[model samples]
Target: MAVPEGEISDALQVLRRVFGYDAFREGQGEIIEHVVAGNDALVLMPTGGGKSLCYQIPALVRKGVGVVISPLIALMQDQVDALRNAGVRAGFLNSTQDLDERRVVEAQFVAGELDLLYLAPERLKVASTVQLLDRGDIALFAIDEAHCVAQWGHDFRPDYLLLSGLHERWPDVPRIALTATATQATRTEIASRLNLEQARHFVASFDRPNIQYRIEPKNEPKRQLLHLLRTEHSGDAGIVYCLSRNSVEKIAEFLTANGIEAVPYHAGLDPRTRAENQSRFLREDGLVVVATIAFGMGIDKPDVRFVAHLDLPKSVEGYYQETGRAGRDGLPSTAWLAYGLNDVVNLRKMIDTSEGDAAHRRRLSVHLDAMLALCETVECRRVQLLNYFGQDGEPCGNCDTCLTPPESWDGTIAAQKLLSAIVRLDRERRQKFGAGHVIDILTGKKNAKVIQFDHDALSVFGVGSELRDTEWRGVVRQLLAQGLLAVESNYGALVLTDTSPEVLKGARKVMLRREPEPTKAAKAAKTAKERKAPVDLPSEAMPVFERLRTWRAAQAKDQGVPAYVIFHDATLREIATAMPSSLTELGKISGVGENKLAKYGNQVLETLTPA
Candidate 1:
């Protein structure tokens, strides 16, 4: 159905008055226009890019309810709550709802009282739910987190595989699929799986410049994480991701012991405990959550100050999506990672032992290699990250490499020496070894295995003594990233590949980065001092900001919702800086929508006033 001119004006009015945005963000208007014009779209926008507006406005302007297929129950609840706070008639149907609650929501949907209805994809599998949908007029179908439809994605949800039935059943309803992260390959897969081949594709820039990316070698990981929190992110909310539940629990305990409020979340935890912890992390201030990858999908928290990876993720897409969770309010947050060679070995072993065909294993390898390249790259991290998403740009000065550039040296001789050692060990012994044993032989360590293999007598033995053990390991990692070396799936041994002979024969030159030494003492001191400085707000506004935060905390507690759900720290900072007096003036603030102004305007004004 073509949107009438009056409805177009109404949509614009909704954008400004209801949502409190003076104008549409880049590409939002176009996507809204297309969807309102009754066309399908596939949207690939970054986190915090205002993606919800693209369909939400159209839902309001259209004739009936908008059906949103969300993957998580918590996410659906949060969205419905936020929409209701904005004065929109919204409700969700999920397993968490009781029979009476579901009946009420179903009645509202049937009565066309809800502007939007959020449903988990599994709900659509029920015949009764499908019939309920068939009886109502659905303005559009929104498939959020569309990347879950790709079978090869790290965050694949089996329920998402059943979403294509929407297209089959409601052929005339315009559908929009949206995700924060998707490669060209994954994009094609989503399109194919969702039957959105002809949908208009809106690929926004994947750069999240507000998040400063930093990857450091994992030396004394616990101490490093503590240092990061104490020195840089004290009194801020953040996430700490680990690869396993045990690690998450341990880290959470450690942080709690060190006087930081922290909680652990993983799939292995009991459902009630998990829900309570998640609610705590969302509702409380300055609470850190140490979790596995299972915890973060569809999280709508906007003020996560940082996302630190205690272990490496599976792929660049996974890393990007996880890190994108931070700085969603467009404030300066961090994406810090502690990565090392062991992460590489463990991940490779995981791929080898995983239940998949050779092709799938190869694809996993390609994904891991890309992630490794990002870790080992001497160039700008943001550029490499955007390049992975098929965008090209100049260096981003906010990342670690751009801030303190790593020195690159022509490691042609070093590469040859390492490759020569592998060649000699393979030629004489007909065997291979992991990087530790190989590095031992190179550094003249004379370990038991090196002596047993008589590798101490090789020509390449002790040739790498000029470089430190860490430097030698860097060479090995770079070679692996360059495809000159491959880990044998069966033995986890570093073996030569087709390209190794060229490096050994001096036919190719390799330029490798010299890993910088850790500067814990000096950097920690500087960071602590920097943390003491006020962020973005003037000194005069500090009191107002603190009072605003106190009020927000009380409001959030009373309502049982996240403080950010009321208004982000960024918006509060703006309010304190601008110091608006009246309701009319408060409405001019970015996040002060009509409903919020009506609800909290007097309280906010009173908070800003003196006693």
Candidate 2:
């Protein structure tokens, strides 16, 4: 579809006045043009890739109101607020609003005053709501985080299953499904669930050049996390993801106690608290959020400096999508993950006990296996991760492997020693203690746990002490990362998997990177206060930048949507620096789509050089 003739110029005004972006990102123009021309689309964009403009601008430029189905009430509200602040007529109907507020939004919809309306899937199921939607002329039906409609997704939502009704209800309306991560299976499932099998597909490359990916074997995860925060991410806007709610609280407390400005977020917190924490993270600068997987889905923060995982994520997709949240502004960011045998065991246990059909279990297992390979691979982690999504690539040359290659050694004997111990322990009691105690028994140390188990009397005892504790730990981590050993599900006990027998029988040789020795002096050389990134953008840019930022804030608030949903900071900086004057000139800026050009182009032009 071609750019809407005059609409381009108008949307650009909204873009400038509300978002301060002089133009759209690379492909956003084509996406908006396609949608504005009335066609279904599937947008596979990286986080911070300006996917929202694919629909947001079109919704504004086209005649009637835009209907957006989003999963998170908080995120929807944020987006709506941001939009309203920009002077667009936007509102959302979700659980957070009272009946009166909902009634007001409904009236606005009926009166044709709303430019866009965000709704939760569950609310859309109500007969009254369905009837109301039937009465309105929906410019487009946008499914945000469309991957959630697919059961195969990490963040699947059953309510998303009801979205198929859109095709049946409004066959003529254009529908757009957007997500940060979607593999082949996930893409298929999304189309199936949302009844968009025929939608035009736009799959952007998954690479986030700004992010440096690293996977370190879990060694005192808290300490390593603290080290990274102190060295690379101090006083930066970042998120630390844990596998559990309790861990989120503990990590937040620890970071806060250590003088970092951080907050905890999880479903376990009160709704008000969750909202408060989210607000703090978004509105305040340089705040870290220690959260469970429950956070960051649909969050539109553009300046996240890093995303650290305290435990291994269940799948590479989950990790990719989460890490993509960082560096949205096109600035450099980092993806740091710490994993251990315990994390692997826990993840396996969760999958094994998950409620699903046989096919589902098998599919999930495949994803887990891929995740394990990613954690264990000594090559570029980014290469292996992208390959799983069917994208082949050379080394990123920016990750830990490309920067510092670790020494890897044949771990065949050590693997045999560990597996032999598990076999002798009868598998039932294997997981009772940690790898250290198991290593002690294999190396013939008379520790209390080993002595109580009488493991010192076995033939495997004292068979392997040549490796130091650090070396043995490395082997254990590699075995876990390779899926050769698992702490029995639920009990945290060690158990040998089928792969363990292969390693023990010499059918498989394990290669593991040797652990680096710690230098006490090096560790103590710098404190948390010394580790923050230098934010050195031009001082001239700061003042107009703040004005542009304030305009964006008001626009976002008035529109009732997250700020980035309007225009990313990268676009804002381009607007500030390039100072484009006309629609033709503005179109050259990244992220200014045809619809965006029509609605926001003039506003940005006016902001840069007021009439």
Candidate 3:
């Protein structure tokens, strides 16, 4: 595994000279050197963990252009812009480009003038594209977002299936596959599908400590989201995820109406509008993009301060992938989600009604079960999240549970009450009821529905009045989460599962977490924000930072590139804090590579002069 001394040195130089990083972060050195020595690797690093460097540096140190295969055509422009800003000769070929544009990039590739070439896996299906690649000298094949190759993965793309032929075609060229997150099972599947079983595997710890994970009960979710944006993340760039496209449009409108500049993105959006919205979100500051799972794959925007989810995610993998998009520049960020009883019932019903066989339905159910466990757990959210990915983590004191530890109370009687009600309705009335009707009958409500059904006539009816309506709802949700309750797919009625008998007969103990009160939850959220690891610039330097941002925005707009493509917020923060008086001093800052310093150094110095 020893990389030659010269190759290792060259990798470090490229990392310093081109990337402006003084040293490698954790396992990056090994990966970069391995790829530099023309060895295959499968890397699983956390998002914002400097993953791009593992391949980008090797491409610079090696002899030929690095070819990257990805399906995120929407982001190739930004990625190439950033690389080109860093002085790397990068070009991309995707459906978005015209024939003339493709010819220009193809000429660059054949002329050996490009250091990196980006392509969608679908483009490889075209014989002309393959022939064009064959005419160029390739240093390595880097499969970005390699997790997509997993058939059961959260973000599977069939085009990724074509990537397995890469190694077979370019046997002499080194190939490396990389993903920000992957469970061990998914890891095995990715390796199997991509023909990388023999590749050396490197997994970094799947912990994003700067991200404070928090989940709350869904109570007027739209208002809760509005409060989160107004109070904590005011004027910060962020993302809000909704489960449906309809919800996406509504949420985006709601935010915009409430004085937040927001946009909507989903599969239903026309291609031009979707592209425009994506472009605006990337290029603008303090804008929120409400979207479905369709949006965030290859986004490299570093200043996204929060990622909020209105509905429950179907699996922990999808949740992790979506939330990981925040704080890509190593800044403090928030990953917040709100869930409720209906979410559980709806997800289960969807699984049961899903278009799949028994095995496929079982797999989908398993993913949902894991997701529910994450939502209902009283333990640290980060611990549960990391555990799902087969990685271990200490209880991060930054999450909601650790901040305001919830109480786990015995709910055996409560469970029996709900289950008995369901049983009574089924046996006595020969009918089933949803959670609302069941809760009403149990709570002694003599409303029209109960009066019409005469549900109060049953012995169990009105017998369980100790718990309030919300408390009873909580019990039902937890039971469903624990598999003691099941939801019928057709009518969304509550039903008992095989395990419900254990709880009903007092043979099993049911434990449930009591959610924090409104005030307590608000205080905990505020405390988390206060206790966050600071990635802020000094107050004295704030003016300088803003000026630099203004200058950078103008440059970005003029050049038709995203602001981060010019320089990240983190880089700006570094510059302001250092208050470098000269170009030499500015070049010493991390992220100030040779090209950027050369391009923006005088302007940055001029911008700082007034401050």
Candidate 4:
């Protein structure tokens, strides 16, 4: 049945009044209408597309409290906090709350005083929780991060598999499962796992036009990081992702010591330290958090200026979701990556030796292939990344390729040579070699590792000498990126997959882009130029803009957040330049949402026209 036109508009009023959002973001209306009409939905919304509101508004307009199966305690807390702050009666039952607190929240939910109740997926399997849901008028059963239900998803959680039971318990309640990242294979698995086979699929475009995707060769990771900090992110909040705990520590310390206000966050840090560091980042302006993947699962910071990857993520899905965290406010942001052969070898080895069935292994190998294709393609990075998620569209000119195309080379022969090395290395004995050793054998390096192992005698050795070690590394990295090769996670072994056969037989030809030299000129240009002020601003109000920024920075520091939370620099610049004197005028600023206007809009006016 089609949604009644009047009801949809009524829902819009609720969205504005309770959530303070004057307008619905793209794709939100359709998803909301579908869920509110009592139908199952699989929503693939990009980050900051207002996916939360799709279910939140529906839950409020529906008959009963929506049961949200969520992933983390921190995320649930953030969600609940945001909802409560919006005047929505939302609460969550998670391990983090004390028993009394849980009892109070549970009572409110049971009394139907709550519009939404968040629960971890693992909690859903508990007989008591299941019984509670069966007894309540569950208007909807919503699963956020629904891709976790899939075995092939990047952040797969074992608990998510139990969510299929929600369908069995509340067979009548409409279920809406949502994820920001889901490839075709993951989409299929999510449907089966959630038992939402007949659900409507709301796969929004994954393109984030605001982010500028850039991948640079690993000339010097630390220097590159400092350069990014000094030039691109002088007073911005961003994340620097590293592979190891040690790297996170060293990088955070190095940046902090060099006068960059950075903090370290990784699994190795104590929970208190991690929380404190995260709080500092969230509540302070100009703070950088160097972390492992543990830091950003459910971060709600809207204006992360840049996301720099010191290590290549495991798959394209992982890469997209991680980078999507930046530029969430729709302003221009940068997505930078430092690529190297070590990342390739490590990722390949992990998938090749993982303890899984052949089908699972092959599935993983396919994901790696898509990731490799992404890193090597001269096409728009956003285009390829979205294409991986089944979003086929035109190239977005926001990425490096659209800005400046890279030099491409036909890597057919090089690909064949690399595959041949994998075959000769023996599939079962994968862990004993590294990319350097393999490349040595391929180019006949006469290195001790290759010579000692007699890999120098292999027929494929030296035949690929036309390429330098760096070039050969690119070939192997591209092969790994293309899913023809993988590293064994257990022993760090490089292993070739079945796809290697086709490439070696010349049935497949791969194109690879040569990594470009570091651009010192671009670095110089950015460093020398001041942050540009908006041209349209009134001349008299320039001082007001500076005062607003100073006030915003102080407010953000008090909250332990980056300045963007208080107001984006672009928004503040526009405010000062435009010189909006009233609430009406203030709301017109680019990033001034109703919540922001209500809480701080008057203060902005006061600061602008002080007595």
**Best candidate (score: TM-score):** 3
For each candidate, what is the lDDT? 0.87, 0.80, 0.90, 0.79
Q: What is the lDDT of residue 324 in candidate 2?
A: 88
Clashes of 1: 0
Q: Once superposed on the true structure, which residue ranges of model 3 sit more than 4 Å away at CA?
A: none
Ranking by TM-score: 3, 1, 2, 4
User: Ten-residue segment with the worst summed lDDT in candidate 3?
Assistant: 528-537
**All candidates in order of lDDT, best leading:** 3, 1, 2, 4
User: Which parts of model 2 have CA positions greater than 4 angstroms off?
Assistant: 1-23, 427-434, 515-535, 539-611
What's the CA RMSD for each of the models?
2.3, 4.9, 1.3, 4.3
Candidate achieving the largest lDDT: 3
For candidate 2, what is the TM-score? Answer: 0.86
Looking at model 3, residue 531 earns an lDDT score of 62
Give the least accurate 10-residue stretch of model 1, judged by summed lDDT.
520-529
- For TM-score, candidate 1 versus 3, the one ahead is 3
